[model samples]
Target: MGSLEEDELVRMVRDFIESESPSPTNSSSSNCLALSHRTQYLILQDVLTGETSSEAKVLKHVLKHMKGRRDTKRSTSLRNWLVKNLKIDGLRASLCQTSWSTSLGCPAGEYEFIEVINEGENGRTERLIVDIDFRSQFELARPTQYYREMIDSVPVIFVGNEDRLCKIISLLCTAAKQSLKQKGLHVPPWRTTSYMQSKWLSGSRKELENPRNDYTGSAEIGNWVPPMVKPRKMDLPSASSALSCQFSNMSLNCCNV
Candidate 1:
């Protein structure tokens, strides 16, 4: 999207958020939701560009190894593989499941994503949210070319701090609502900002131990080896599956973010 169009989209999102915010002072909330065009550009840049940050390094390593891996077709499988391999590389990685109760017309739902905890200097710790298929989360049904271009800029794999992730979620959810409205479609509750925020911001953490046995693996990137472990059964229902089952009549695409 061009700079002028990008600015207009941001303004539209900002206005939508402020209108929905319960607080009388919309400016305060608007300020919080305000993500400049440059900031949005940098989100993709941070993921694509080489960076020395620990999180960036880990993201790069994971992406490199994940390339051409046929076993990671599903989001859950991809996250599990990443956690196991990241732990082998001496990083504290785990699977996080976030679920929220029905509220404000949104249905109850659960989501799964990967989380990596970084223990920094002086005992400081940072938690990063890693969504392997991030861009798919914001995809709308029959989106306009303008909206499609905006979403295309989102990185496929998103690794960032909570604040950064929240901002992105807010921006995308608002844009999704606008796009749907333009198409004369009802914005499903699952696509709302509150629901999207619940995906990453709220959940329980499940840490899987590295498998004792090691298996050799090869890919175009290099000889990437991930431990061989039995596929553990998770009783929790993924948000996509749950929503699809619940809203079978609704002609909406289920996004497993």
Candidate 2:
């Protein structure tokens, strides 16, 4: 099994490179193919996260393939080939909202924001429920893969200025560049932005603005809303008294009798 796996891996790499465009047919609309050692490292970072396999193991394989080359100045021609550019609106509410990346040992959820707190000098915190989408039971281990990790042993508590009090999780904005360097590939500094925009900062200013509701310059600070639950219908039980009755004849007051 191990030998077969190794052979399969080698063949795949060989085919991946051969498929690249070897020669250009036109200057304006050129059909060309090219890539570098560093590009593989960058892809490995994204693939490792989405997959369940160990990142180190996958990284090792990618590095092994990128070696034996003194490649330089990766062509930005691939930049024009990007298809289906997607930019998410952070302002929009998601069915599932998450504070920390699930793999980083944080809550897994699509929970509604209970409230956004802003603490100016002290910091920020977000108070939310583990399973408050509709009912508590719905947020169990099935969808979120919730474990003891979800509950958070230490409640991330903070009490200070209400200006920057909302919970904000910072993420790797340039993690890919570092990942490439670790695997022995050096890309130019300018190419950093082209590789990938940090996912966290892609949202708009209002969406990214200190999750804190505090706005020293604007009136929106006071306009912050409190949770408002919608009204629901309920069934009323019919009047029935087997033990005691208002009627004198039917009344059976066994205890008081």
Candidate 3:
């Protein structure tokens, strides 16, 4: 599909929003207004880049309504359409492809898709593997291992559907976490690239507010106290005895002199 002009894309998205979800009397013109500013910007960016196709639109709509266990015929139809038509092995090259060193996939938004290729039998048979790679949200590795582990366990799923896409993402995360755990490395909640340490905040505040969940104790100095020492007491003669001894000594000294 040809890329759309900014204004035309906005109008089409607004129309789609109005048709899909109409707001109440007191609400805004459409439910799209309720989306985050970043999301709105991404929508515009995708549209302008010609990435906002019917499949993408349907996935976005389904994701927006995934709060509860709610299901609808429209969503089911979209999912069915994707499962029936989309081929997992040979997808559009623009979407995902493996290269000499790097494998480029979908845009790295909340998550990204990756295509891993493995050659077997002297490159006679090629294995086209698809896996989810958390981008800015989290980190993932060993795409080939994850694909092999997941392919036999889970049934074939059309990732064009938001629900299935999310499932695939979560599955990959779980596998990655398990792998890390097996290696005695704890997987953090947020990606390592994200800024968790800041100089502005105190050490204690930084640890507590860290999303990694690895921080448990405060980084602030503890209320430590030094060990106390008791003074040693020395016994002294009485004042009267000391006076008598001094007088005796004086008398002895005079006689000696």
Candidate 4:
């Protein structure tokens, strides 16, 4: 993301964080939380906009294949296809299944997403989380207009490092709590920040190995037809530009939930 676009998103999230709460007695606590959130948001922006990051390259290919696939297919099937195709393209990608036991009032659950491992400079390794349905993970049953717009601005396909994903989960979970409180509804345990963090952070990750001859009988293998006639490299900018436009006009609007 560009600096201008990043700043705009940060500002919008800040406004929501600093907005008045239903309980004025917790104003001090809310201020502290807002400060922490702002710090994490800035760190996340830095991680996302790193010029030397290999995530962009992997993400570009992911988006290309995703755009070329049938939308009716389930995410699991899409993820499997992506893992196979990415490996064929010489990228180390795999299906990551994360399962965690219930803790601190959060229920036990398992989540599956794609992950790409890249060997960075200086023998460093980077893990990128590629979530196809990222935005829906933060969705609420009923939300204020501002909250709805904020969540809607999140990219449908999220490609970021673990740190970036953690910060995003934290920020969104906090916002979810605020939105539910504003609606005079109870914040479910599943919506807690800890639960959200466990989904991607604190879990046993089992990477599914790519099978040999997996693509032999698949009709979708090695024959992706893009929806439009465009250069593979050029697709990234178009996708980012569309999301940037959405973030540009994002603003906090008061509404009864």
Candidate 5:
């Protein structure tokens, strides 16, 4: 990779259009530019010692020229122009992973497999499923004391007592329920109550599977919305024993503004 003057680069692009050096295959010239050619050209910039302030400024100016054309749909493609060139050859990274023949006991894309070569297995992989979500709920101290009474007082850090746990369960459930509504999906009527909240305390003196103290009361902004959109949860083979979410079961197995 070496630096060519900005004007030289422009001239090269024009020459590409004239000669059509990389013959467009099934894709249109616009498609090639947006998706592939653009990426290819950006890689070309690396050859230059863009480290200099003057170089950066010039580069910025050239890029600005493209921005002006962006409003034109033809100008606003995915790859910068260089990327389009990359796709013309055998340079494109496969869009997704390949090489695993999933087992009959599994479904496609359902199980995640990671490559591991150990214990005499050359390309062995382990099936893994990870489910996690922003959690807000914990016990409050003083079972006999109502939260309103203790509201003005310093909040007990952790240890949600039965009553506090009840509230947390209620609020989290409500929050989840409300959030599901916002996602344009419906939580099933039968499972709605369970998803809303559950109280599973073993006995007194023990601890609840208490969540952390960070209660956003809102969804962690960009975090995935809970996947409560099960078209049918009970019809599956494991329905009788299933009591958890398919998406964050931590069996496994958020919010507002």
Candidate 6:
């Protein structure tokens, strides 16, 4: 992620904390200090932006806040907020909508997102299950091997690990790219270059290809793919040419979830 992106993420964290946490001046002992909330926001910013090498600060922050709470309540709450507030919901919703890249258009492996809720000694724990059927979606020559065996073999990541969830998404997106590459197919040129006209280009293909961007902008600021606009007749050829140049120069850096 670029510096611009990191700042945007930090600002988002601030907004959430400010909105949810009680004001310190209210004098309610049960209410956490606003300063403490700010500190935690900074810690999360560092963790997400890779400014901090050690997650010890984050661990300490969680432990301190969750002292009497049972079974990692702070972690669970944070994880839930991330899942619900972030663009994860939007991405899942996209599955219900029609896309130009579906079946006849050389779609990637089909994925089903399932949520598992379980009762545990601690409380209720939730896990996200991603079932990708590469064979059917990509029309593979050997269906059973990868779909029935390999893709299913990848472990379902629990909801708490945002980083792990990102990896899982990146893997899925990579599979999509690979399928497109193998078939010698490409997404429409206009879809790829529309971001540039909106002054939203991040100068990296990683930003362009991030699946999170396929949803709303806040999902990933630097990588957010802008909503498309109708271009004028004269701008059509230039935009098309620019998209072609980008595709030709694109690197295999598909991990920006």
Which prediction has more favorable TM-score, 1 or 5?
A: 1
Residue 108 of model 3, lDDT score: 25
For each candidate in the order shown, give its overall lDDT on alpha carbons: 0.65, 0.25, 0.34, 0.68, 0.28, 0.32
Ranked by lDDT, top first: 4, 1, 3, 6, 5, 2
Is candidate 1 or 6 superior in lDDT? 1
RMSD of each: 20.0, 22.9, 24.5, 24.4, 32.1, 28.8
Q: Tens digit of lDDT per residue, candidate 4, span 1-257?
A: 79997787677555544442422122222332554434444533543454245878888887777774434444566678778778888998889888888766889998888888899888988888888888889899998775676676677788877655655665567767878998999999888766776666654879876444433335556675568766666445678788877676563222322
Error of 2 at 206 (Å): 8.6
Who is ahead in lDDT, 1 or 4? 4
Error of 1 at 97 (Å): 1.2
In terms of lDDT, model 4 sits at: 0.68
Query: How many pairs of residues in model 5 come into backbone collision?
Result: 32
lDDT of 5 by residue, 94-133 (tens): 1112222223222222111111111213453322111011
Q: What is the lDDT of residue 114 in candidate 3?
A: 25
Q: What is the lDDT of candidate 6?
A: 0.32
Per-residue lDDT tens digits for candidate 2, residues 118-217, read 2223453322111111112111222211122222221222111111111111011133233345556664432233111111112211222223222233
Query: How much RMSD separates candidate 2 from the native structure?
Result: 22.9
- Ranked candidates, highest TM-score first: 4, 1, 6, 3, 5, 2
Best by TM-score: 4
lDDT of 1 by residue, 75-179 (tens): 565566667777787888888787777876868888888888888666989888778877888887699765687788887787877655655665566566667
The residue pairs that clash in candidate 6, if any, are none
| Candidate 5 residue spans exceeding 4 A from truth | 1-158, 188-199, 202-257
Backbone clashes for every candidate come to 0, 15, 0, 0, 32, 0
Q: Give the TM-score of candidate 6.
A: 0.21
